[model samples]
Every structure is written in C-alpha cells, then in structure tokens.
Target: MLAKRALSIAGGLAVLGWPFAVWLALTYPELHILLPILALCFVLRLCALRGKTGALSRAFKGLALAGAVLCIASIWMREAQLLLWYPVVVNAVMLTLFGSSLFSRMTIVERLARWREGELPPEGVRYTRKVTQIWCFFFLFNGSVSLFTCLAGNIHWWTLWNGMVSYLLMGLLFACEWLVRQRVRRRYE
Candidate 1:
C-alpha cells in the first residue's frame, strides 16, 4: 500500500514536471529512449483499468492510449518534443473526471470530504459540487494553455508554465478554496 501511494505521488510529479524532464532529455539525447518506455507503462496501467466503471476511468483509458500512440510516433520520428503531449492528455483526463463528477450522484470533492468527515450536511454537498465544477473549468483552461504552449514553438515558456507556474496556480487555488471552505463551515456552524 505504501509503495502504491509513493508510486502514485511520483507519477503525478513526473507528469507535472514533464517539461523539465523534456528539457533534460533534449540536452542528453540518449535519454530520449526512455520517454516511450514510460509512456508505454502508463498506457498499460490505464488499460488495466478497462473493467472499471465511471466515465472518468474510461476517458483515462482512451487518453492513455492516445499518449502511448504519440509516444511511439515521437520515437519513430526521433522527436523528443512530442513528449509535451503528456501534460495535455493528463489535463484533459482530469477535466473529464472533474466535469463528469458534477453530474454524478457524488462530486469528487464530496467523495474526499466524505472519506474524511463521514456524513455531510446538505450545504456541504452543494459546496463540494461547486468546487468540483470550479476544478473542471480550471482543468479546461489549464489544458488549453498547456496545448498552446506546446504548439507555440517555444520550449522556455512551456517549461515555465508546465513545470512552475501551473503548479503554483493550482496551489493558490487549493489554498484559496480551503480558506473559503473554513469560513463557510464556520458560518454554517
């Protein structure tokens, strides 16, 4: 279990810091070979979830396949830049997960809250749904920015946003949400 959690965190960081990894790989051409292997692993792991329910899981499976295809193409073309698609695909999957949860019986935020707080009040459910919706929009916007950076033909900007700015923005949003949640909880109390 601990290994799983550690791997999960490492995988997430890898995705988030992909642009930097690409930069390093570009500098050392020999590292290019590893990109497709990592992507293939992700594709297999996602494929393993074929039997999982939920639109989000299905979307991930499809996205992972797309990523794997791109990875293979990059390998064939000897284009390390193609690795930029990793974050774009990941953001889209996240967008789908958060967006789909808005219409589900329980939004993602609500599920996390429930795991920690058990039963929640009606207001909490509404709040969680709103938060989930907000995250959906964030992912959509962030994904667009990521795609734009990838296509803009500038590695510096892409690395800056994907490796640093994006995470800082997400952290700010998370911190702001927590502050608002605390105030709202106090008001309800």
Candidate 2:
C-alpha cells in the first residue's frame, strides 16, 4: 500500500510537470508529444492506483478518460508562459488552502469517506465532518472568487474557463456521490 501510494505521488508530480515541459519546449516543436504522453501516464497510473475494480471508479471511467483527453487537447491551445503558469497558479492555490490537510496524509473528504464506509471509528467522525466543512467552504469561496476573477479577465480567458471547469467537475462529482448516497440511504431506511 505504501509503495502504491508513493508511486501515485511520484506519478502525480511528473504529471504536474507536464505543463512546464510543454512551455519549455514550445520553441522546439518536436517535443509537443510530451505533454499528452505525460497526461496518459498520469491517467494510467491513477487508474492503476485505483485498482480498476471499484464501482465508483467504473462510474467515473468516462470522466477520467475525458480529463486525460482534455488535458492533452487543452495543451494544444496553450503557448509557453500561459501553459507554465496554469497548473502553477491552480495547484499553488489548492496547496495553500489545504496544506495542513495534505500534511495529515488523507484529505478531509477522504477521511469523511472512510467514516461513511465504517472504516473510521465514531470518535474520528466529528473531526472529519468539521474538516470537510472547512475544506468545502474553501473550495466554494476561494474557488468561486477565482472563477469570477478569471471571467473578469485581466488574465487569459482560458484560465477563467479552466476554473469554471474545475468548479463544474467538482460539483458534478459531489452531486453524483450525494445522489448515490441518497439512494442507498433510502433503500436502507
């Protein structure tokens, strides 16, 4: 498990590097293939880390594939400076908001899932719920503001669009999970 998690982290770092690599090699047209290939590796590694066996993973299969495609397709639209700054800004914001949570190993929502699955004892549930609320508010507030500012466009319109997509993606996944949980709860109740 530790090895799997470590590799996932390593793969994620490499994936994160793709944008910069794209930007750096922009003057060298032959290297255009690198970004998409890196994205493919990330998607593959993420799939491997997921074990390709869970129902949720299967349900999100299309989305995962689409994200990979989008990453590659989006790169085709980006040039040097903008491409490099894209993930740098987004991830920096995410990291600033969730640094402590990252330090704790699992994200707040991850722990919440553990509790929901009965993997966590009752004592941890309260903290998990509180942390989840904090993180969600951060996502909603800072994220929405970022999206709006992007729309106002002192920056590239693409960044704004990217922020909107991020918001939509998270919202879609949350809604899907909530719907599924609601159905399961109704069945049990």
Candidate 3:
C-alpha cells in the first residue's frame, strides 16, 4: 500500500512537472533522455491505479496510457519533436472527460462539490454545471494554444506558455471560481 501511494505521488509529480522535464530535456540531452523517464512515470501511474474502478479512474488510466504511448513512440522513432504534443494530448483528454460529464447525472464540478458538502440543492447543481461548462471552455482554449506552440517549433515559446503561463491561467480561474462559489453559497443560504 505504501509503495502504491509513493508511486501515485511520483506519477502526480511527473505530470505536474512535465513542462520542467521537457525544458530540461530540451536544454540537456535533446529530449532523448526524458522520454524513457516519462514512459516509466506513466507506467508507474497506471500501476498505482490498479484495483480502482470508476469512470474517473478509467479516464485517468486512459490518460496515463496515452502518455506512455506517446513517450514510447517518441523513443522508438527517435523524434524528440513528438514530445511537444504531450500537452495538447493532455488537454484533449481533459476536455473529453469534462465535456462528457455534462451529459451525465452530475457534472464533474458537481461531483467534486458533493464530496465537500454531502448533497447539493438545485441551485448548487445549476452552479456546478455552469462551472463545468466554463472549465470545458478553458480546456479548449488552453489546448488550442498548446497546439499552436507545438506547431510554431519554438522551444522558448513552448516552454514559456506550457510551463508557466498556462498554469497561471488555470490558477487564476480556480481562484475566481472559488470566490464565485462563496457568493453563490451565501445567496442560496
């Protein structure tokens, strides 16, 4: 159990630090060295998810599998350029997961909100659905920018956008959402 937890942490870090890893790869060994490490991380992540069964778990497993496959292909083909697509792929997977949740009984945001507050009233449900839609739009916009960076073939631009700017944008969005949620909750109360 401890080992699994450790692996899960490692996997999470690998994902969160992906842009830094890519920057290091670009700076040092031309990304050849990083591909194998990324593949290992993805594999470990998948292993950590073993015995978990749910739509969310399945989505995460699929993401790790996709990452592993991308790294493996980059290694096999000896094409470091292929590594640039990982961010785009990540966003695409996220968009799919969040967008699909809209049609389900609960939006992804609603599911998360439920975890914090037992059950949601009608207003909460509507709010979460709107929040989920906002997130879907963010993912779409972010992914488009990521794809643009990849196609531009400029490492500095790619690193800056993917590594720094995107994270800042996401954080800002999250902060804004939290503030809005507070107001919504107060009004509903």
Kindly give the number of clashing pairs for every candidate: 0, 0, 0
Ranking by lDDT: 3, 1, 2
lDDT agreement of model 1 with the native:
0.78
Estimate every model's Cα lDDT from 0 to 1: 0.78, 0.53, 0.88
Between candidates 1 and 3, the TM-score winner:
3
Residue lDDT tens for model 2, 46-151: 6655756543344334334444555565576764333434433443445444554545666555554785675654444444555555555655565565546444
Among all windows of ten consecutive residues in candidate 1, which has the lowest summed lDDT? 7-16
Looking at model 2, residue 184 earns an lDDT score of 52
TM-score per candidate, chains pooled = 0.79, 0.43, 0.94
Give the poorly placed runs of model 2, Cα more than 4 Å off. Answer: 1-10, 22-31, 50-64, 75-123, 145-189
Model 3 Cα lDDT, one tens digit per residue, 61-139: 9888888888898778876677788899888988998999999998888998898898899999999999999999999
Of 1 and 2, which scores higher on TM-score?
1
- Give the Å shift of residue 7 in candidate 3: 0.3
| Model 3 TM-score, 2 decimals | 0.94
Local error of candidate 1 at 162, Å? 0.6
Pick the winner on lDDT between candidates 2 and 3: 3
lDDT of 3 at 41: 95
List of clashing residue pairs for candidate 3: none
Q: In model 1, which regions exceed 4 Å deviation? A: 1-6, 27-30, 33-37, 40-70
Per-residue lDDT, model 3, residue 174, is 98
